[model samples]
Target chain A: MNPKVSHPRIKEFEVVTNPKIIKLLLDGTRKDIVFNYLVNEPMTVKQLSDAMKKKPGTVLHHVQKLKNAGIIQLVETRETPRGIVERYYRAVAREFRLGISERMSAYDDDTVASKDRVRAALLGLSTLGIHISESDFEHAHDLLQRLIDREAEVAKVYDSPSNHAFQSLPPSTRYDVSYRMSQFLLSQDALYRKTLSDWHDLISHYLRKIESEMV
Target chain B: MSWPSNYPDPEDNDRKPAETSAAAPSPSGILKDFKVGFTLAVKNFLSFGLAMLGIILITILLLLLIVLFILIPILFTLGLPFLIQLVETIATGFQTTTGLTLVMLIMFLVLPILGPFFVALGAIFGMARELVESDGTQAESAFSWYGKRGLSLLGGGAIHFLITLAPLVIAFLAISYPTWNPPSDEELRVIIPLIVVWIILVNGMLSLTYPGIIDGLSAVKAAGRSVRLACQFPVRVLGAWLIITVLVTIPLIPVINEVAFLWAPIIPSDLLEPYGALAILTLLFVIVPAVSIVLTRIYMILTAKVDATYTQGADST
Candidate 1:
């Protein structure tokens, strides 16, 4: 009578932490590339291999490790040669949280690894910001800002009588407006990230110049 | 609690699954069903337009108020160095999760209650619109479905929330217990089992609750029906969800990084200037709600279709 008893597969999804499980996830290089690519979004193994410049067989090995870890999952698949399938992988969690601060705690002085991670994070952040900032500036900043403000204001009015006016507009129109806003935000973000990256580089250059003078 | 006798008897040797009168709809019949559904949705939309607008407006205002309430504590706690540092890091890493949780809480808990009230109002206006479209004699005022059906709708929403949350509440308790006092290895041993239990409970709850809520059935009755339907056709429900998730996730791949960057401001930043700060705030206010609404609509459409199919089967029986 119990639902759990009735559905055994549901019970099989335990947190797999074993090294063997990790090995299983990274078994093939193709799978590994696919899993890494999916840390951003779901990607077909072909897309993964193409991006990584690796053979499909190689990529599949690593993807299996990610799958076993419950870190990457099959989002979907498409048919290919001889009815072979190509599955898309997506990371299970969107965000990662470290329980303790790695920087503050004592650990191996892997400065190179740390530096690489920091650089990647910074670059990622800067690229995203620059894109958004550019989009924001493209449409006269004031005009776009006003439109956003108006939408916000309209969104605020919640009296009983105005519901008719709200409903009269097609749902698609609302969706269209929202979609445009998201696209705009995305562009602005890209721009912002780029700008930040430039600023960081400039700051670093200046700091180096100051250090040279001090030396 | 037993399977309904009216269920198509698979064991009957004489009758093939395909031979049943209602086993599968003809293409024309499918088209007709679609047409009817579209009409109903349109009617519902039109009649409830004003009420829905009001509900949305109120809901948004309430959300802003809730956000303010949540933020005030953080601002006050910022005076404490430890708390401030913790908040800063969480803000950076968990921006999307925080935003999503806030949005989900508002949508699932608040919207459902307000939604049916508006729907009833819409149904009344929709009937009036139909009469007008037909060139029938117009009455000064139409019968209000809200006045007649408000209680049932509100009751259904209440039941929906409670039934849906039961599993989540249990999962939360299970997950949080270990965190209060760090678990020993023996206690950690139980973690996998607990997680598995939690996933099954959560998924099963979601699969069942949406249909039950839409149908305005009591939680027990809805849950019972859902369990029966899910067990009868496990692959169909799971496959439907899996396919939907994959399809939805595909379009999101290119944009995920962009979305995260846009949302990053909800976390505190020492490096960003006043202008940069303002831009982030503006982005959050404008974009977050829009994205949430679009996603919610997609979910409704998918779940509603699934519910409608079951309703059709029930009607045939």
Candidate 2:
């Protein structure tokens, strides 16, 4: 009944060295058992209920909560008698990792931020993202960390004038953006290939703009 | 791991789906895909059918339990015992002649929605497992990822509904067309072609949705993947759909005629018509299981190709 929790279908969760996801997943014990049982194969709420000795409705509520938290998904659906449709839900992945992607300190305790702050940081990251390479990332890890520090500082300074020389940009000049970052590989599918091509063009256009600014 | 060992460099550039599909080897042809599908259907015909049947029965049993659960409140309200309430409800359904609009509404609109998604998910899981595992474990493996990815599967199903929604809308308009405007042969030009395209798109995507789900893509991504695959190999997907439709339809010719009260001579005119039984038999034994096996096989290939495209992407990167 807590209005704070959103519907299970829309909630995005992260597994990190944090209990936040675990909390969002619901009380630790039941979800732990449910998660463990579901690790090997998919099961309907009924099957899970019978096996766990929980009522089907109770199991369904937990399952939906877990699913909404992005831990589970529907694998298939079918039409039955009349127009009734049944769904089978399964965990999103076979294995669960209770850590961030780096398995480190969840971006060194800086990944957590207000939405607008994170969004602004992400916009900068994405803008610079296209140009960075594996070698560049490795060589500049420390530098990147410094940049992240600056980004955090900037967001922190947004509401207060800076003690340091770094002044927050005016609201008119500030922006927030979010983009899905993935290491896309080229493909043979003409359509997929065209998407990549279009992406490359867009990125090139941005890179050119960056170059112009630099000049 | 987050620090990243690999990332696509700027030179990796943009690549579109058409380019990806085209650069890739031709998809498993419709005939070959059909042959593979048929072989799969034949190989696991009984097991797959039984597995599907098991899922169907299990789902129905769950729905029945749900009905019982709901009936508990009414049972107490009616001053009747639990078992008696069960009997009364069933009796009421069959014996009562007066209108039960609420009951009918729940049965048709609400309850059907509940069961169909789960049932479809179960079949996909089962058939996908059967196709992939090729062992005794396949039957149970169908439910392997059930609780894990419920949303994705739900999303996938929803995406499919949305994809086919256009056709439904078109069909509605076509049905309503004469009401608003005079029917003309020119409408056929648009309607017929539209129907053909919709059929290809819908059927092609239908076959590939599972493959994408099985590959762990979300419903939206799966639908997109299926559409790309369909566009790449429209003929194969369409042909496979045609072949399967024909196979299922061939057996139902007599049943169709019997139900339609048409030119079916297979049954004697004086014979009693178990029309309902015939329809159930055809659907449960033949249509559901056959479609499962065939589509599973087709999508399995498609999923592999889909995977290959990614690996190919990785290699290029």
- On lDDT, the candidate that comes out on top is 2
Question: What TM-score, over all chains together, does every model reach?
Answer: 0.27, 0.44
**Model 1: per-residue Cα lDDT over A1-215, one tens digit each:** 11111111112123334434433432345334433455556665556656777544334435544655566665433222221223456666543222122311222337324533332232233332321222222233333334444445444443224667645668797567656755556445554445545555644654666678779
TM-score computed on alpha carbons, candidate 2: 0.44
Tens-place lDDT digits, model 1, residues B1-317: 88778877567342122211224423432233233333333443433344344444555665577656766786786656766786686566555443334345545556544554433432333232222212111121122333433444355445545655555555555555545344578976786567555555445434443333322344456456555544543443343334334444444433343464354344334533554555543333322222222222222222333433111111111
Off by over 4 Å in 1: A1-215, B1-54, B58-216, B244-317
lDDT of 2: 0.50
Docking class of 1: incorrect
Evaluate chain B of model 1: give its TM-score: 0.36
Q: Candidate 1, DockQ to 2 decimals? A: 0.01
What is the iRMSD of the candidate numbered 1?
Answer: 23.5
Error of 1 at B148 (Å): 5.4
Please, what are the lDDT tens digits per residue for candidate 2 over residues A26-66? 35435554456655455555456557775443455466566
i-RMSD per candidate, Å: 23.5, 15.1
Judge the docking of candidate 2 as incorrect, acceptable, medium or high.
incorrect
The sequence of per-residue lDDT tens digits that candidate 2 reaches over residues B121-151 is 6455545433432322234434444555556
Local error of candidate 2 at residue B243 (angstroms): 1.7
